[model samples]
Structure formats: structure tokens, C-alpha cells
Target: MQKTNELSNLTKWLDQFPLFHSGDEVDEVRQKVGHIFVPHNLNVIGQEQHLSADMNHLNLENTSVNTLKYGAGVKITCDPFEKFLLIMLPMTGVMDAEVENGRVKACNDVAALINTSDPLSMNWGEHCNQLIIRVNKSLIERTCETLLGHPIKEDVKFASALDMSKGHNIYQSVIHMLATNPFLAESAKLYPLITKQLEHLLASSLLLNQQNQYTQKLLNPEKIITPLYIKKAEEYMNEKASEAITLQDVANNVGISLKTLHNGFQKYRNDTPKNYLKNLRLELVRKDLIAAKLEKSNTTVTEIALRWGFIHLSHFSESYFNKFGEYPSATLKN
Candidate 1:
């Protein structure tokens, strides 16, 4: 059957489920599936829901599953021991996910792998659509163990998110495989391929998470200030001096406390963060001034300074002389 047709059929089945019509009864249904008590409404149409013989296994009818409506928003509270991973591919709109520590915004073409055991909330905006798959944790772990040729750690969670662009491609491929090769879905022989893809997706997410985390650390001081963190912060300051920025903004981005950030920068650069940022701004202004000297030939010192976040002309002039051994006007004259 065509993928759309299959999904449509699945959606039909889900709509027929008693839980869909029973307003608050969906909570009971979810709780029975090992989720903690929470009030949320599910408006599913078509064959969006499916279950295998095993209670833990489920095949989300991708075709018939059109809109997975979350009445009070996409706030799903999971039981700690549920041991299920939810793979969600948002077809349209964006999803804002809030966890204990942080939040991330996920949009179309991206896949979010939510650990149902974790206390997290998802906010799905209007016009949003998605394909959701619920997989048993044991099944995934066993698949990973067999693929890696060893026992995988149970506690180490894969990235709870995946890049939509890459995920969309993978989702399409999976759907194609499942639709064209029904036997593969039935026999569980496709576990190897699934495992490999899952591993790759998780790895990608981890790398992205680390990169973002590292970036946040670099921009904030309360976080660890490694050499790389300092380097990245310096680079970012240099690149974004023209934009409206502040030390607090930098610190927040780096995920560090303000005091710790100052100390780290002082230790590494031997200068205060404000002073360092000022110098960077001055450097960019200097470059612009030098270029203007050749091009416009009449760009004033105040013009260049103000253009680069130097609000006070006297301070700008003093800093300019200290760094380059010449006042702004002197540079223009030379």
C-alpha cells in the first residue's frame, strides 16, 4: 500500500480507539501505559495508533496519523520506569520542548527523541503536524548491543533530539522501507539497519548538544573556562562587536555565572571582560578607520568610535592611544 494510504488507515484505527472520544479518559489510557498522571487531551484521527502483540511494542501508523493534538499543549509527563523512547517528526510548525535543565525549539523536518521517563514538556504550536513512534527501551538497547557487539550502557541516554533536516531524510527512508518491505517490519530482522540508523542519529544529536553546550560555556563564566572556551568567546566577540551585545549576554550564552566568567577571562586574557570587549570593538573600528582613510578620506574619529559601541569619545580616544600608540585623529592624519 502507498505510504499515505497506510498512514490514513492507521489514523482511522486510532480515531476508533475509545480513549480518543473519552475527553479526560486519555490520561487513564496513557497512565496504564506507564505514564504518570497528567491532564492532556489527544485528538487523533485515522490509523495513527497501532500495537503489536507485545505490550511494549507499537507501530505508529504514519499514514493515517495526521494531527496529534495536545489540548493543553504538548505537555506529557512520563513515569520514571516507563522505559520508552518517543521519536517525533514534526511535519509542520515548531515544537518548544521544556525539560528540567533547559529548553529547545524544534521545527519542521526535525525529529525529537523524547525519553518518556524524563520529566519534560513539549509545546506544539498551531498548524503543527507530526509522526510519532513509540519504541520499547529494551528493544532499542538489545538492538544497539547486537550492533555494537557488546552490552551498551543503560544509563547513557542518546541525544533527546535530532536535527530535522537530517531526520526528515531518515524518516522518509524508514517509511519507504517499512512500506515496501512489510516483511522487514514483521520479522524484526531489520533491527540491524534500524539500530545503525538510530546510533548515527543519536551520535549526531550528542555532537550538536556538546557543541551548543560548549558554545554556552565559552560565552558564560560560571561554566568551566577551558582554553577552547576562551578562544571561542574571543572569536565570537571579535565577530559580533557590531551587534548589540553585552557582557551579561556573553556570560548567559556561555552558561556561566557572571562572576566566574569575569575570573576566567581575567585569568586567560589578563584583562577584564569589559576591557577585552572594548579592545575588540576598538580593533574593528580601527580597521574601519584605516579603510575609511583610504576610501572616504574624511571619516571622523567619533564616527568610527560610535559605530563600534564606543559611546564616549574621550574614553574611545584614550583606549585608542593606549592600544595603537596614537589617538583616533592621529591615525586619520597619518
Candidate 2:
């Protein structure tokens, strides 16, 4: 049906759909489709309406479809659900989808899909338009298997929305076929093609997910430890332990944001940036103490600690004792 003439009809149809009206009902739907409902605009009359549909064959107990109409600056809220995958295609304008801690911007030529099995809220605005497909967990899993060589892990939170990139032309072809060919409503031959396209799209998304994981690993290696910055910071700490060193110094030397550095270290080392540096200095002191013992040489605990950035003799002694369960002098004797 023409988008304009079908707007009201589609709205009426959505109102009657099993999962559109109530929050509880939406939740049940999400368990099957993996998402909750949000409001959208359907203004495609004289001008082309940006047509987007959310479809879930598994969630609908077969197939369920929802249509949206949104304008500039308009807002809508969809109830959260567990295990939802939403595929959105915008026909016109641009759309920005925000979910939980992540966001994606999409234009007419692109489509975005976001997958989440946890409760989430989304906001779209500013000339945003879209088509959404909500697929069930099992169906998506199966589809992923067909597209990817291996199965998708259950815990992975797929994007709630994805913008088509390399697969844009393929996606557009599917959209055109769905929009113009009424025969698609009945022809069985189209099923294989549709499934194939879905597989391609899902595979592309899987790659994107892997890339995002790698990026996050690079950005946040562990507990404020980044691979790129850790070596630099460690070298600086070793050289300047006797001198005062601050997080800002390390961040500036490495040319990264303090927060980024902190997060990177946290991910890589499982410790705070400052703590890791301090531990490194303490390790140097311990090595020196042990080396003196091996050489049958004498080195004062105070001298070793101070050389390694421990300014307060007593405090250094306490920290050293706590770490190694012995006084620094004991280590020198060992």
C-alpha cells in the first residue's frame, strides 16, 4: 500500500497487534522478539514517508509488525525487555539511536540494528526516521549460525540498532522488493532470498561487534592500563621513582586523556593507574633488596625504598612488610 494512504491503516493494525498496547504485553513480546515498544511517526503522505517496520517472526508467535511516524524533536519511550534485537532502516532523513551506554547515527542509505537481552531505554530525535525489525532470540541465534561460522554467545549484547554499511545495496534491494512487490506477500521463492539477506546483515553485524570489542580492549585494556601507554608509564616510573610522578604526567607523556589512560590500565592490569605505578616502584625496591642479598652486600632498607619513590621511611617499611610479609631488611638477607 502507498505509505500515506496506509499510515492510518497501519496504526490501526498496530493497535490491535498482540504486543503493542501494554507494558506487560510488550515484555512478553520482547522475550520472543527481544525488545520493547517505542513510539514513532508515520508521516509519509504527499512527500515520501520515511517507512520503517519492526518485524519479529518468532515474537509474534509467527510474525509481528509495527509501523512508526515521528517528526523533528519528537520523543518516544519503549518499555525495556530482556533479549531483544531490533533492526532499523530509515527511508529518509537521519536518525540517532541511543541505548544504554552506546549510540549510533543512521542516514537514509543506511540501516542500523541493536541487540540487547537486558532492559534498556532509547531516545531518537532530530529529523529521525526508521524501519525496525524485532527478531526472537532463537531465530537470531539460528540466523547468526547460518551467517557466521560459529554460534553467537548468549551473553553478548548485540547493538540495539545497526546502520547498513557495505551491505547497504543489498539491504536496499530487499526493501524495494518488500515495498513494491505485493507478490512477496505470497511467493514462497522470496523466502530464501530474504533469509540470505538477513544472514548477510547479521554476519556484517557480528563483525562490527567483534571490531567494537577490539576497540574497547584497546581503549580500556584493564583497570586504567592501556597497552600503548603502560610501557611508557612504566619506563617513566622506573626512571623517576625517586622524583614525584603524577597521573597527569603519565597521561601527558603518553598523549591520552587521563580517564582513557585510567580505564585502559584498569582493563589490562586489573588495578588503578596510580596503584599500578606504585606497585611497580615497590617491585623495583624488592628486586634491589634481593640483589643485595645475593651479592652478600649491605643496603639500608631506607636507602632502597627512598630510591624507589618511598619518601616516608616508616610508611615504606609498612607497605613493604604488608606486601611481602616481611621487613625490607629481611629480604636483603634472603
Candidate 3:
């Protein structure tokens, strides 16, 4: 008899990897599943039924893609995940999940995101099968920081539901390709570089697509290119900080209009170019003062301040005190 083809890309992908585990014993299946995911309680919900569990796990450098199913109706409970986030995409049937925020009925074209810190319980129908993507918690946070161009002051949290039923979803497409394509499997093994890049692509997709703490900042068109523009402006300012360069000069050198430069800095950095340059010069002056103190040099504060473009001693001293809580002389003195 000819074998029937599987309809889900996830099933095709799972065929490439060796079967991680498969059995009917509930305890054995639970232990094997827990080893791949997290420790959890799994029980058959129907009377006179036993588990018909099948699992295939594919581990990449920073993420894992998996497919799992229990051929009998089952209930599962898991404590809050501490180290990874799970995206559960159902390929067939339905899985109802109770997450921290609310309940989600995940099925074809609708998915559930298990946030790293949310407690979870799920009920899988006897025929339900799912493609689960497990991403390292730190990787997602780091990607958020990278996209924002700053450290995240708070733990990043994503909304628990993802609607893939509409529009082009790069994340969903990539995951689906990963599940069904044999080229990626071979490429992942043959090229470490491609593996890392693929991991980043996966993280970026979910972050940019799903609602999250950083989504507004990440998706804002005005803020999107601001980080790059601001960074270049800062670089130009730092190079010409001690020179008699104007904000217009900095803007011209950085290839942005003066007004744009000003608006970008004000909106993102909360300071104008003039103030930022002044602060930068003030820092340079303080560094010299500290160096002079350490070396016991006879260099006076006036001479060092002048070299850094600060013409007025009194004004410079006041700004220095405001920034460092001490006068320039105090910084230079024992």
C-alpha cells in the first residue's frame, strides 16, 4: 500500500528529524515531553482511554521547533515558564488554553503565545496536533533591546494571542518553511552562520508581528529610523565636540536637515543637539580634570576648560556642578 502524505508542513519537517519519542504509556510520554518542554502534569480526560503520544523535536542553536500530539483527549498544566516563550500553532483540531490573561481557542489560522511568565493550562482534543516554536527568553529580550537601541528597563511581555488569519506574516511563513523544508535542515548543520541568522529572523518576526511592550516603539515609523540618524549625529558631534562647530554643521555632516536632527534628538534623546554637545564637552573637560588630579599635573581648570570649547569659567562650573554634583575645582582638587 502507498503511504498517504501528511498535510501539515510541520509534519513534513518532523519527518526529517529522528523521532524523539512515541508511546502510549502516560507517564513515559509525560516525562519525555517534559524533557523537551517544561515539567508538567498530563492526564487523560476521557474514561477508558490511554495516551497515543507522538513527538519530534528539532533543536537549533538558540531555538527549537517541535510537533506534538496525544491521540487521546488530554489535559495539561504547567507552571509559569521562566526561561523561554512558546508559540503553539495548531495544525489540526483545536487546543483550548487558559493563560494568565484569558482563554484562547487555538486552531487553524489562530495561535496562542505562551509568554515567559504566564501560567498555562491546555486541553487538546483527541485529534489535535500542534507545531510549537520554543525561543530562548534571553534571546527575545536581547532582540527587543537591539531593536530599541537601548536596554529594556522592564521585563518584556507579549500579549498571549496571535492572529495569523490575516495579512502576510513573516514569522508564520518562516516557521512554516522551517517545518517543511529540508534545505534549512541541511543548511543549519552545514553552516553555523546561517543558523544564527535564522534564529534572529524567527525572533524578529514574532516581536515585530505580535503585540508586546516594545511593539509601539519598534513599529513607529517616526521612531524606526531615529536610532540610526541619532547615532550618526552623535558620532559627528563627538568628533567635532571640541571644535567650533554648529548644530547645522553637525546636521550637514550627518546627512540630515538641521530641523530633522533637532526633532529626532528631542523626541528620542530628550535633548537638543546644542545641549547634547554642551554635555559632551563638559564630560571631556571632567575627564581631563580627573586625569590631571591622578597625575598631579599643574594644569589649571581654566586652561583645560578652554581647550574643550567652554569659554566662561563661571557658566562651565555651574553646568559641571549640575551634572556631577560638584564644581570643576572640586573634581580637580583632593
Residue 50 lDDT, candidate 3, scale 0-100: 61
**Pick by lDDT: 2 or 3, better one:** 3
Candidate 2 wrongly placed segments (more than 4 Å): 1-66, 71-73, 118-120, 124-129, 146-152, 159-161, 165-172, 188-334
Q: TM-scores across all candidates?
A: 0.38, 0.37, 0.64
Whole-model lDDT for model 3 versus the true structure?
0.79
Best of the candidates, lDDT: 3
Computed on alpha carbons, the lDDT of every model, listed in order, comes to 0.51, 0.50, 0.79
lDDT per residue, candidate 2, 1-334, as tens digits? 1242332332343333333322223333334333344333222222323323233221222122344434433333344433345566654455556666566665554445555443333444534434455544444444443343233334345544443444533434443333333343344343644644543454344433534333353334334323767777767766776678798988898888999887876665545778767766877897888778667776787888877778888888887664444578776763
**Model 1 lDDT per residue over 1-334, tens place:** 1333344334343333222332234444455433322334433323423211011122321111112433333334433423455556554456776654456676554566665356666666554444555544544444443333233334335455555453343444553343233343333333434544643444333323423333342234343345766666677777778988888887777677789778877676556778778867877887887788768676788887888878878878887775554577865754
Model 3 steric clash pairs: none
**lDDT by residue for model 3 (1-334), tens:** 0011233643665765655545788888888899887899998986538677778888875678788877788999999887788888777778999998899998776779998888999999886778888887767876776777654556668888877564687886677666666676678767857877878888898889888878888998344445687999899889888799998898888888999998998777656789889878988997899799879999999999999988888998888875554578976884
At residue 295, what lDDT does model 2 achieve?
79
**Stronger candidate by TM-score (1 vs 2):** 1
Once superposed on the true structure, which residue ranges of model 1 sit more than 4 Å away at CA? 1-67, 71-74, 79-82, 126-128, 166-172, 175-334
Q: CA shift at 189, candidate 3, in angstroms?
A: 1.5
